[model samples]
Target: MLNNVAVAAVNGVTPFELGIFCEVFGIDRSAVGLPVYDFAVCAAEEGPLVVGDGHFGLTLPFGPERLEEADLICLPADRGAPTREYPQPLLAALHRAVDRGARVLSVCSGAFMLGAAGLLDGRRCTTHWMHAPALLRRYPRALVDPDVLYVDEGQIITAAGTASGIDACLHVVRQEQGAEVANTIARRMVVPPHRDGGQAQYIRRPLPRTACDTMGEVIAWMARHLAEEITVEQLAERAHMSARTFARRFLAETGTTPYQWLLRQRVLLAQELLESSDETVDAIAGRCGFGNAAALRHHFLRTLGTTPNAFRRTFRGPQAA
Candidate 1:
């Protein structure tokens, strides 16, 4: 039912983020049996607008009035969104759009605009990690999760930096339409249909060194033998330490218990098999050391908040399933 879309073009808007909205919603893809949105780019004030890159400008076809009728309102990143104040009328327009049941999405630093409008108050949201501290400092009530690619809070969605906008947009499409439509759109765009990992997995942080080199060696062995049932005592024996000592050091080094870490890695392996291979659920569960499909389902849902079948359908599409 989400057909009409509009992007709010603020001055100093990042061209790539603005272009993401146009590429995803503005194009007419009806020939491929995809839903074609009535998309438009609208500005806060009429006339020529300067882009963020400082070397170029753009002219929007419509004004804020276009946002009034849109089912989805997209706010791409603007260079000035961090410190510059938004126009009162523009903020009111965004509030009005959401008040009447329209959804709003912010890409990267565009989350700053939503925070300024007070839309992110008491809501779980995220911006680019570099700006997350600033966002939290600016809006103390906003629960800013910096480790996610995007946070979906029903009517409002906020994404991390740059390319994460595509993931957020596709999430909306999958929710409104279905995995098939979302996958088809992703195929046309030549991006992954669905990314299984969160931004935390991609964060480049140096691991803390342990007192001994035993933890790393044990971890490497665990990864290689994920299909076998692993025990803390067994791992402790392999690492030449007591079980209690191993458990304490493992938590200190990895921030999680040995059992929890092993379970999570097994679930991650199951996800890869479900997405990239034509394996049966029972077979995958066994390979991942879950013993059966029920066990896999239990762990998968606990870890990822979704079932294996749903995850597979999301990545492989309807016919591929």
Candidate 2:
């Protein structure tokens, strides 16, 4: 259903963020059976638009009128987004798109455009952590959560920083088309197919005191053994540190506690199994260390806002159920 896509470009648009939309939606991937969108770069302003830092200028073929036909509108970050005022016509087009059920996505400071349009009012959204305070100050009604990689408020998806834009875009593809299509595109892009929207935007940690002082091996081991029962004390023993010290170091390195990390990894593993295999919920529950289908359902609902069967059906289709 999301066949027509348009990227909205204004003055001082960041090339990298714009490229993220182009790379995700503008490419011709029909050769591999993926949906090829009717895509264009639409100029929101009349004159030649300058890219960030004045590296280059773009004379976009499509104008604001092109946005009216799009099923999805992408707003990429601009250098002056936090303070600059968006054109009224451009903001009105955004309002029309949302009012008519089309989705709008903003990458980094692009959220400012949505805020300026009043679309972010009363909606939970996010921007790059650096600009989160400004976004909140400028738009007090918007619930600006600065920590997560992205926030998906159904019609509006806001991604934090640069690379998380890829995550948010892929998330839309996976939701609209299915996991197989999303994963294939990710393989073509040489990037991970999914990073949960709830993931920390950035880890709070100082430079490593020593090259060898890290939780890399422990984290990798945890990932590989998601089916096994994992405990903080056990992980501490493996890391060769006291339980209290290990907990502190793990939080520093991972931006979450050991239990939360393991729980999230288990959920991710369960999602993969549900999508790629015809495994029963009970079977996957055991494989992902949930022990039983009821336990899996509880955790799935808590973490993903859906039950195991419902998630499987979403990705694998109703026939899967």
Candidates in order have lDDT scores of 0.87, 0.88
TM-scores, all candidates, are 0.66, 0.64
In model 1, which runs have C-alpha deviations exceeding 4 angstroms?
206-321
- Per-residue lDDT, model 1, residue 232, is 92
What is the Cα-based lDDT of residue 241 in candidate 1? 92
For candidate 1, lDDT tens digit of each residue in 114-156?
9999999999999888889899999899999987789999899
Model 1 gets an lDDT of 0.87
In model 2, the runs with Cα more than 4 Å from the true position are 196-321
lDDT of 2 by residue, 241-271 (tens): 9999999988877678888887877877787
By TM-score, how accurate is candidate 1?
0.66
Tell me how far the alpha carbon of residue 292 in candidate 2 is from the true structure, in angstroms, after superposition.
26
The Cα RMSD in angstroms, rounded to one decimal, for candidate 2 relative to the true structure is 10.1
